[model samples]
Target: MTTDEAREFARSYVRFLESMHELAGRGEGNEVVRRVQEHVGEEGRRHSVVGRGFAPFEQVNVQVALDRWSEQPERTVVVEGVTLPPHYGPVTLQQLLHGEALPPTRLTAPELVDLPSGPGRTTACVRNGLFLVDDEARGRFVLFARAPQPHQGEPVLQLELAGLPTDEAQKVLRELDELRTRHNVYRGQTVELAPEMHGGLSVVFPELPATERADVVLPDAVLARIERHAIGIADRREALRAAGRHLKRGLLLYGPPGTGKTHTTRYLVQHLAGATVLMLSGRSLQLVGAVTQLARELQPAAIVLEDVDLVAEDRGFGPGSSPVLFELLDAMDGAAADADLLFLLTTNRADLLEEALAARPGRVDVAVEIGLPDSDARRRLLDVYARGLRLEVSDATQDDAIERMAGVTASFVKELLRRAVLEALEGEAAPDGVVVKDEHLIRALDDLLDSAQGLTRALLGVRDGAAAPGGGPEPHPHTRQAYASSLSFVAEAGPGLQPWR
Candidate 1:
C-alpha cells in the first residue's frame, strides 16, 4: 500500500493496542486480562490484527484448525476462565478486547467448551480465549474464539489474528482456512442438526445405524434404483462431471411409516465412505437453507431429510405459497448443478409434497417408493432380524408366520422377531440350548395379532390385515394376505425342525 495508507494502518494498529491496554487497566485485579494486555504489548511493536467469524456449529472445526496450526515449534498459552455475558455482542478484534467494565469483570481466562470432533467424540475448544501463540511460520499472534453463548445475539466462533501486519494477517487467515477445510472434523462424519437458541444450529455427530445393503429389506430392483441415484452417482462423480452430467441431484423415498426408508438411508450413508452426511428430521427440516450452504461447502455430501411431510402440513396449497415446504425446495434448487451433492428426502405422506415438488421440478430428480414389504422382502426381513437368534422351527411354521405377516412393515417384522425371543424364554427352563421354536413364533404372532394390539399394530406401521389398526375398513385387508393368529401346530411337530442360518 501507499505510504499514506501505511501510516493510517499503523495509527489504527497503535490505537488497537491502546484499546487493549485500556481494557486491561479497567480490570485491575483480573490477572487474565493483564496477561492479555502484556502479550499484546510485546507483540504489537509493529503489528496489526485481522478477524473472521464462523457459524457456531463450526466450533469443532475451529478447534481442529487451531490444534493443527499450533502443532510443534508453535506453542499456545491458553488463558482460561474468561467469560462473556449472554447479551454481549462484539464483532471486531478491538471490540472483543474492549470487554465490559472493570469491577465485576468479564475476564479471568478464556473459556473452553467441548465440541464433537467425531461421532461419540469431542474436543475441548477455546471459547472466548486469548490464545497467546508463538507461530513458527507466521510468528506470534493472539487469537480468540467466540464461544457457544447462543443467547449472545448471532454468536459465532470468532477468530482473530492479532499482532501481525494486515497483509500477514490475511495470509495467516488463508492458511487457517485451508487447514480448517483439509482437516475438518465434520468432513466424512454423519451430523444431525437441530435449532439451538434463537435460530442458530446445533450440529452433533450422531452415530447413525451402520446398515448394510444385505440388511436393507427392500426389493432388489428398488434397492438398486436408490443406489443408482445416490451411491451410483457419488461413486462415478468424476465420470459424470466429464460427460456433462450434473451431480447435484435429489432422491425422494416416499412410503408409509416403518417401511425401511430410514434404514435404506442408513445403508446409503454407510456405503458413501468419504461423503459428509447431514441428516435432518421433523422441526430440524426448517433449517434447510443454512444446511444447504454447509452441504455446498462439504461436497460429495448427502443431505437426508426424514419424514418431510411433518413440515408440509397444508397440502394442495398453491405453488410458492407453502412457506416451509417451498423453502426446502428452494434450498435444493439453490445448489450448484456441478456440485457433488445428493438431497435424500423421506416422507410418509407423498401427497403433501406433490405441490412443492411440482413447484421445484428438477429439485427431486428421482422419486422411489418404499412401500409395504412383499412376501419375499418380509421373509428376508425375518431372516435379517433373526440373524442373531438361534431359530429352530419347522418349514410349515415359518411359512405360516410369514404368510400371516402380510401388509406389515419392516419395523413390525423386527419387533416380531424380538417378541418371538421373549416368547421362547417365557416358561422354558435352560435345556441343552435355548432355541426359538415353533411354539414361540406361533405365540408371538398370535399375541401381535390380538385385538388389544390395535394401537401397537398401528405404531408398527401395519396398514391392514387384521383390524386395519386405524379402526377403518381398508380395501385389501392385509393388503395382500391376512393376519392369522390361528396357526394350529405343535412345538415338536414330529421333529421336522430346521435350524435357521
Candidate 2:
C-alpha cells in the first residue's frame, strides 16, 4: 500500500477506538446508582426514584429550598434534551420510576430563574437542574428540580430523588419541605394567589391599604367585635393557648354589597401586622384548599375569602355539590385547635351561605352583620373622606348632607365628598384652592340621587325608596317637580327627594 493510504487507515482505527472508550466511560456513577436503587428495589440492581410536588404558588419557595440544598459541596448539571422524547416535551425525574427512559442528556451549566422573593425583592432559583449530592448525612443521591412544563403535561414545580433508599428519600424530602416553609416568601406578607392559564398558581403581592382604627367607620361596638376576634385574639394567642383556649377562630361578615364588608376585612388585615394575609375574592375563592394548606405552613395567618357565597350553590351542599364550598369548610375545620389561624369570610348574600354553613357547623365561631351606615356613621364617613380636602361648607349644610345621605353606604359617603370636590372644580372653583361649598355638596348629592343613576345608586349599595330610617328627614315642602316625573305627580319635592328608582 502507498504511505498515504497507510496513514489514513491508522487515523480511522484511532477514531474507532476513541468512540468505544467514550461509550464505555459514559457511565457516571452508574453502579452506585444501581446499588442505591436495587437496595430499595426488589432486585437491588437499579436506582429507586422518589419525588414530591410544590404548588405553583410555591415556585419561589421551592427554588429557595433547592438553592440552599445545593449550597453544599456538590456538582450540578442541567439535564438537557427534556424535549427530545416522543411527545417532544419536558420530562420530570419521577418519570424514571414509571419506566420512562432517560433521553440523551449532556451535563451543562444549569438554567436558573430569577423570581420575586418579596415586595421589591428578587432571587435566583434553579429552573432545570440536577444535583449529584454526596454528603455524610444523606450519602450520595441524584436530586432534580423541574419547573412546570405545560406542553409536557407537568403542571407543578417537581422535585425528585433517585438511587436512595425509599425511607431515606422520604426523610430528605421531608427536611426539604420544612426548609421551604422556613424560607417561605408568602409568610407574614399581604398577598393573593393568582392562577395561571397553565393551571399553576402565581403569588401576587398586592399593597393592602393601611387602615387605622379611625379609618374604619363602623359602629364602635361592631368595630370592637371585629378587632377582638381577628386581632385581639391573635394578640393574646400565647396566653389563651397557655390556658388551653383554642386559637382557631372563624368570623363571617355578611351585609349588603359595598356596605363595608370588604373594607372591614381590610381593616382587619391591617391590624394583623406580621401575619400572613391571604386575600381571595371572586372566582379566586376556589383556591381555598391550596391557600389554606399554605396558611397552615404560615402560622399567624388570616385567610380572607371575600364574597365566599359567590362560589357556593344557592341550594343545598352535598358531596360534589360545591367543591369550592366544601374545600372552604374543610379548610376551616381542619385547623388544629391550638393553631393561630383565622378565617374571615364575607358575603352579600348571607341567605345563600346559610345552607352550606349549616351543612358543616362550627366552621364559623362568630357572624357579624355590617349593614348600612346609620346617621352617625354617615357623618363620620363624610368627615373621614374629606380629611385632605378644603371644606367651605357650613354646619347646617354638613348636617343636611349627612341627613340626606341616610340609607346610603360608606362607599356612597366617600364618593359624595369626591363628587363635591369635582363639582367645585367645575364651577369657578380653581384647582389651586378648590373649596367644597354647601352648594357643591348639595348639587353632587342631587346628581347621585337622580333617577338616571339607578344602577349607579345600586352599585353604591344605596337602598331603593330613598327614605331615612326612623323618619329623620321629611321630603322638602317647597320645590318644583322633576321634569321627568312632574306630570305623574306635580307635588313639591326637592332634588334630594327624588324617589330612589
Candidate 3:
C-alpha cells in the first residue's frame, strides 16, 4: 500500500484500541470488549473476521515540562498528545527524556498480551502500543496489547537499558559504544563531522564544518591580512561592543572565485567561540520569513547570507521588494543588538549589491576582498598537492613549472596538480608511489594557460614578454619595461607577481 494509506490504517486502529483500553480500565471491561469486537466483526460480514485493518487513533493531550535536574541540565520535552500519569515527577520526566535506555518502570515491546491486564499484571504504553510487565525487578517485558490512540506528536523512542540483565546490559552498552564510535569528531587528525550529531537545528557546528586553513595556499599578503583581522578581533575583544542600537554588525567578503572567500568564513566560524554558522544561499531568500525566524533562534551565530547581492538588491519592484529586504534588515538589526552575534556575507559581485544594505551603519561592519593567488602561493599550492607524490623532475624543473603557471589561480593550480598526480599514480600502491615528471608538469601548465580565457581583470594587466597569443594589442615599449620590471624573483625560482595571486 501507499505510505498514506498505511498511515491512515494505523491511525484508525490505534484510536479504537486506545478508546477500548481506557473504557476497560474504568470497570466497563466486558461491555467495552464486546462493543469493540462487534464493531469490527459486524461492521461488515463480508470483511475478514480475523484480520481486519486498524482504525485511526485520536491523539492524547500530554504535556511534559522539565522542572529541574540535579545532575544534568534541565530541558523540557512536551509530550504533544499523550498525558502521563500523576505519579510522574520532574525526575521521572528527566529520566524519560534524556534516558539512554528504557526505564525499568516502562513495559517492553514483547510482554504486551492484551489491552488491560486482568488481575495482577503490570502494563505500560510504548511505541503507540501497550506491553505487559513480566517482572518488576528484572523489568523483562513483552507485547500483549496494542492500543490505538491518535498519535499527537512523534514519540521519543526509548529503550530500557538499566532494566536489562547484567550480561545483556553489558552487551547492549557495547553495541551502543560501537554505534557512537562512528561519530568521532577527529578522524586521524583530519577534523570531520561527528556522524550522529551532524546537522539539524542544534547541529549548526557540523553543518558549518571547520575549514582547514592549511588546505588552501594563499598569497602572503592576503594571508597576512586575514591574520591581522583575526588578531584585531582578538585584541579588541575587551573593548569591542555590539554595534549600537542604531548600527548593525555584519561582515562582507567579496573577491574573485577560488580566492578562499568561502574558506576564510568557514575557518572564522570554527575558530570563534560560541559561534554557530547559519548558511543561507540566494535561493532560500525566497522564503525570507523562515530565514528570519532561524536567525532569531540561532543568535550568537555567524549568519552567512552568501550572495546577498542577488536578493537584497533593489530589484525595481519599488515598494513590493522592500518587504523582504525590510524583514532581512530587521533580523540583522536584531542580531546586531546581541553582543555575541556575528553576521557574515559573501558575494562575487559586490558591485551589484545595494550600497545602503552593505554600507549602512546598522548592517555590515567590515568588508574584505579576497583575490587571486600570487607566485609564491602557486609554489605552495603545488607542493601541498604533491606532498605524497614522488616527482621525477628536479627542484629546478618544479620551480620552472611554478614560474610558468605563475598567473593562474590557486584552484586551477590544484586541479592541474590533481590531474597530473593521478596520471602518475595509475598503477602504484605505495604511499609515495606517484612520480610526477617535468613533462607532465609542463603539459599541465600548457593546458591551463592555453585554455584560460582572456584576463578580464588582474592586479596589473601588463603581460609584456608573455606574448599576446590571442591577437590582443601588444604592450608599448614603456609599458613592456614596466611590466617586466614590476616583478622580481630569484634566478631559476618563480617570478614574484605583485598584488594579484
The most accurate candidate by lDDT is 1
Overall lDDT per candidate, in order of appearance: 0.72, 0.71, 0.43
lDDT of 3 by residue, 289-345 (tens): 443443344434446666666665534224655634455555666553534445667
Q: After superposition, which runs of candidate 2 have C-alpha atoms over 4 Å from their true positions?
A: 1-45, 73-90, 94-109, 136-139, 149-154, 314-322, 430-432, 467-501
Candidate 3 segments whose C-alpha is farther than 4 A from its true place: 1-210, 227-248, 286-299, 313-319, 323-330, 354-362, 426-432, 452-501
How many steric clashes between backbone atoms does each model show? 5, 6, 37
Each candidate: RMSD to true structure?
Answer: 12.8, 11.0, 17.3
For candidate 2, give the lDDT: 0.71
Worst 10 residues of 3 by lDDT: 58-67
Against the true structure, what is each candidate's TM-score? Answer: 0.77, 0.79, 0.48
lDDT of 2 by residue, 1-501 (tens): 999999999999999988756543443323322333333354322556788877666878987876676664543322321222355566555543333344443444666677777888887776766665665665556677777765466766788887678898898898789889998988889887665675555667888777788988988888888789889999998899999998888888876666788888888888886899988876667667778889988988999998887777532235645467777888788878788989999876666666666667677767777777888998889889999888989999898777777667789889888899999999997658889888999888887776566667666666534544233232332111221222221112222111211
Candidate 1 error regions (>4 Å): 1-50, 72-81, 85-92, 96-103, 133-141, 162-167, 194-203, 313-324, 467-501
RMSD of 1: 12.8
Q: Write the number of the candidate with greater TM-score, choosing between 1 and 3.
A: 1
**Model 1 lDDT at residue 131:** 72
Question: Of 2 and 3, which scores higher on TM-score?
Answer: 2
